[model samples]
Target: MQKTFSEKILAKYSGKSHVVPGEIVEVIPDIAMSHDNTAAISKTFAKIGVDKLYNPDIHLVVLDHCVPPANEAFAQNHKDIREFVKKHGIKKFYDINNGICHQVMAENGHCLPGTIMTGSDSHSTTYGAFGAFGTGVTRSETAVIMATGKIWFRVPETMRINITGEFQDGVYVKDLALGIIGKIRADGALYMAVEFTGPAAGKFTVSERMTLCNLAVEMGAKVGYVPPDEVIFNYLEGRAAAEYEPVYSDEGCNYDAVVDMNLSELEPVVACPHTVDNVKPVTEVAGETIEQVFVGTCNNSRLDDLAILAHVLKGRHIDSSTRLVVIPASSKVMIDAMRLGYIETIVSAGGTLATPGCGPCMGNHLGVPATGEKTISTANRNFKGRMGNRESEVFLASPHTCAVSAVTGKISDPREIPVDMALIFSELRKATLSPVLMTR
Candidate 1:
């Protein structure tokens, strides 16, 4: 019988000839990732009475959520994780300077095509950009994986989103993601694998594709995937650490649902203050004042994102009342942005640069908004109290929208701001072609 990508991959890893949705199968993931929360997982691992990891080579530990330690408690958590890594001799460890765990994994060659990876963070689905079967598990589940190197998965039904048409100016991949979430609501694809296909899928660069998968968890998807192609192969050329065989769904494969999205019909949109699914076109909420503008997160912090921010704020200053903060997704992305002068342009335009990590995305540290204040951010979620302060508000949008809002000090539409797409794309090309980004 024809099978979906999820069914085929799970079957291969589980050593089965064929498997279907809802079947539980045991398999060992190619990579298991954990971030700041690893400290807690380590404790649970120790409780399991396993003095050593089942396979150190399969584990990746990254300290990113509260880099440099937000306080005494957070510092202790980092310290515990470091000790755990050193004790276990985990070779794939990255310290706080590395950046977000998901970005670090992708850049360091851990997110290969046709492989299975699990992480403690929900956005672990970001690995699907490279066509990997990536998912997030509970902390206890992560601990179990660390101790045993084996995990069981119940295969999920597949949902296909076939996108068509080219993106309009100022309308971006982020808008598409938000539009989908708005239409389907938060629980739209709970415990299901969402596959992105159709002609437009090939047109998105690898970085753009990452955005598509990174937000999959926001809609309650178990995982997301985009079939690997030459674009993905080109990205993994020098970066991939292991040999991989790409996987694809069969032509006659069954799917739980099939949705079509027309890119030309989309406009710049934002997830409103309280929920990710409460999205509205930018024009509908224009003039809502903001106190802070954040342009970084695992979802939208990269060289391409920085280039867009710099392009929008070039030779212009932000609103004096608003604070603008920018953080690159990874150390490599940070270096490339610096070399391309994106950092200098942003800093000169009244933007504050923070250490490359998940700064302010979780409200753990760095640029948390004051109580009763409003922020326009590029993060995937905007639920109440998401940014540390229960009374503050966050509006989620694309980097383009965040940059424009920083200048206007309100929830403004990016299309209203004159941007030279040609110039922005030219700068991005320079950053993309840099050798620093090509390193594994």
Candidate 2:
């Protein structure tokens, strides 16, 4: 029987000849990840009454949220997570100094194609960039996996999205993602897996693909997949830990729906305050005043993203009225940005750099705006109160758009800024292609 990529992977892991959507199966995960939330997961693990982990190697604990601890309680949470890691002899632990868990996982060779991995964070779907069957689960489900190294899934039907054509100057992968989510509606793919295919999808770099898959959850997708090919293989070279069986959807596999998109028709887009699907082309919101601009997050903090922004701000300074805060997704990304002088370029342009973690992105502490203020961010999600004060608003856009807005002190279209495409592409090409820093 022909099977979709999700079905094929689940069937292989579950030892079944065939599995269909709506069917539940017990399968072992290649990796089970948690972060500062591990404290909560540990409570569930304790409730499960398990003294030892099913497989210490497969369990990963990262410290990202509330990094450097916001308060005594947050500090205690990390303390408890450390104790849990030590108690179970878990070797895949990453402390606060490591940066975001999703970024760390990908950079450290834990995410590979054709593997099943789940985490307690919604953005765990970030692994799908490498063609992994990745998804997020509740703490209870994660605890069950902690005790047994196994979890259950109701195999989802697949929705195929085929994209073609080249992205015009000033537009990027983030715009494409927001465009798709807006068109599909917030819950269009509820409980389904989305497969991205076609020329445009293939043209994207691994980091660009990560930006797309990371936002899949916002579309109500259970998971999003980009089939592993030369791009993935190239990124994983000397990085992937174990031999992987490459998998793809069969030619005749069933799909619940198939959507075709032409990248050439797209314009830089953004999601207005209070919703991820309330998207509009940049021209629609041009000149909207903004008090701040943010240019980093798990979704858009990659080297290519920083390089693009740096190219735009080479000799210009950001608007004095609009504050700009830049955070690298991981320490390694931070180091790369510095080595390439992108860090200096941005800083010299009046951008403030935050530590390498999820700061301000979740409204935790850094760069919080005043009530009623507005911000344009490269991070996914723009729900009210997501970036502090409920009255303050966030407009989500591509890094290119954010850079231009930071310079203008208002939401602005990148098309208004003159850019040398040849120089921008050259700088982008200099970014490391390896998904994981093989040597660092």
Candidate 3:
């Protein structure tokens, strides 16, 4: 006789005050985000003749994507947008040197639990790390949210992912995410709200949680939510994020389905070339050589990640056959690492370091591999032509794995280099990682 938790949340978002998932309910969106990727979005929004953004204070304009813009012209391209944002009275623009769009908003606490939010970027779903429902919408849709605090949503069916067991050495959150993508496929979860359950997701950090939900859109998920808990509360308290009564579904709240998983023996993993869903344990794909190892991206370049690679490369040099590239997620991350001597270790070991920007990942600048060259990355996404070269082969792994691969030239696993990687791991475990970017 009673509705499930999913049914309740869906109904409220869909439109009705009563339990309804498909009602067109209006919520005063407390937060929203936009960035350079949508620089042209405004022009498109005007095509439909929308005069203003939903609510200026609730909008954040992040400039992380092409920051320190590659060329003088593109840099100017963003400059124009900066001027426009100012004209539009946008107050929360990150500009260059701030950080990634998703990273900044998530870190600063624009996201609150149990609210619906929207952004122009597909990865906007990353806000689910805090149990909020966020999704990527078209620029016009984003503009509509900008013009009106409310947007539309049809209550989506929910899917439960359950994981039990501990991850083995060298595997990190990315691998787990890729594993889920592999199981769900690119479109398997279309229009659904993905609620990660089970022990494994619970063991993840706020940063890791962001990484998991960030990729939800890749599977066509409408949103990705993790119920509130101590981790969520701890991350939000003392930060710029909104103060909300921590909300979560009761333990007895209904779920669409329960997924039980045991991840005890999970090994270092890779989401193979061409697809994020092509997952295979690193052990199964070992001996695969690579020509480059990249460390850093908005999705993976946290202090903890840098520390992990710093440990792996402490005394080891990059292999002659492999080139190592590291781009700090933002100026703060770069500056912080430099302040702590992590950057020194990374560079002294023959690792090539670049300023904070999305270079290699965009394939526009940086180490664009030659045809047939195998590359390993710590960043998210590995589609063909994604990294500047059309035929370059890419492999995705954790920072530890990326560093180890650089040391050995091939796709090396950090676990195999224990002597050189132990202290780093120990240090990483004790390091205090915080969000370096300003987010909603």
Candidate 4:
């Protein structure tokens, strides 16, 4: 029987001739990842009475959230994690300077194609960008994986999303992601795998593809995949840590639902104050004043994102009433942006650069908005208190929209800003060619 990508991958990992949706199978993960919360997971592992890991090689620990220790409690969490890593002799460990766990995993050659990875964080689905069958599990599940190197998964039905046409100027992948979420609502694809396909999906660069997969969890998807092709192969050329065989769905494979989207019909859109699915075209909410503009997060904080923000803000200053905060998703992204002068341009334009990590995206510290203040951010979610203060509001948009809104101190359409798309693309290409991105 023909099978969807998820079915095929799950079958391969589970040692089955074929698997169907809702069937549970046991499998060993290529990597089991956890971040700062590993402290909690470590405690659970200790309770299980496992003094050693089943396989230290398959475990990857990263310290990102609340890095540099926002306070004593956070500091203690990091301290406990370090002790756990050393005690278990886990070689695949990254400290506070590495960046977000997902980006660090990709840049370090861990998120390979045709593999299975589980993380303690929901956005583990980001690994699907490389054709990996990635998903998130609870802290208890992760602890169990650490002890036995095994986990069980119930195969999910697949949802297929097809795209056509090119993105219009001032519009981006973030807008497309928001538009899809708005149409489907938050629980539309609960516990299902989402496959993004078609001409437009094929055209996105690997980093852009990452953005598409990163937001999959926001729509309640168990995972999201962009079919592996030359773009993926080229990215893994020097970066893949292990050999991988790419996988694809069979023709006429079954899908629970198929959604068709036309890129040409999309415009600059934002997820308004309270929720990710509460989206509206920028024009519908123009002139809503903002106190802060954030241009970084795991979903949008990459070199390409910085190039767009820098290009738009070049030689222009942000509104005096609005504060701009920028954070690169990883140390590598931060270095590339600095080498390309994107950092200088943003700082000169009145944006403050924080340490390269989650920063204010999680509202843990760094750049949280004051009570009753409003912020336009590039983060994937805008739930109440998402940015730390329950009274502060967050409006989610693309980096282009956030940059433009910073200049106007209001929710504004990016098309109103005159920019040379060609120049921005050229700079981004230059950044991609850097040696830092080409190798581990």
**Which candidate ranks first by lDDT, i.e. highest?**
1
Tell me which of candidates 2 and 4 scores higher on TM-score: 4
Cα RMSD (angstroms) for every candidate in the order listed: 2.1, 2.4, 3.4, 2.1
Give every collision pair in model 1: none
Off by over 4 Å in 3: 1-10, 13-15, 19-28, 250-254, 419-440
lDDT at 412, model 1: 94
lDDT of 4 by residue, 1-440 (tens): 88999899899988899999999999999999999989999999989987889999999999988878899999999999999999999999999998989989988889988899999988899999889988988899889998998898999999999999888888899999999999998888899999999988888877777888999998899999999887788888888889998889999999999999899999999999798999999999999999999988889988888888998889999999999999898888888899899999999999999887888887898899999999999998888988899999999999999999999999999998957777766666666432222110
Worst 10 residues of 3 by lDDT: 431-440
- Model 1, 1-440: lDDT tens digits are 89999999999999999998999999999999999999999999989998888999888999899888879999999999888899889989999889989888888788999999999889999999899999998899888998899998999999999999988999989999999999998999899999999999877777788899999998899998998888888778988989999899999999999989999999999999799999999999999999999998999988888888988888899999999999888888988898888899999999999998998988888898899999999999898999999999999999999999999999999997867766766666676532222211
**Residues 1-440 of candidate 3: C-alpha lDDT, one tens digit per residue:** 35544456555555554554444455556566777755676666667666776578877788866667778877876977787789788887787777777776766678778766678778888888888878877777666766666766666667777777876667777777777777778786887778887756776777777878887887778888777676777677787456674345556655555545456656678878988778787877777988888887766887767877777778778888888889877666676677667899999999898767676787867677888898889777888888888788888887777878888887766688753334544444444345422111
lDDT of each: 0.89, 0.87, 0.73, 0.89
Candidate 4 vs. true structure, TM-score: 0.97
Residue-level error in angstroms, candidate 4, position 104: 1.0
lDDT of 2: 0.87
Which pairs in model 2 have colliding backbones?
none
TM-score of each: 0.97, 0.96, 0.90, 0.97
lDDT of 3: 0.73
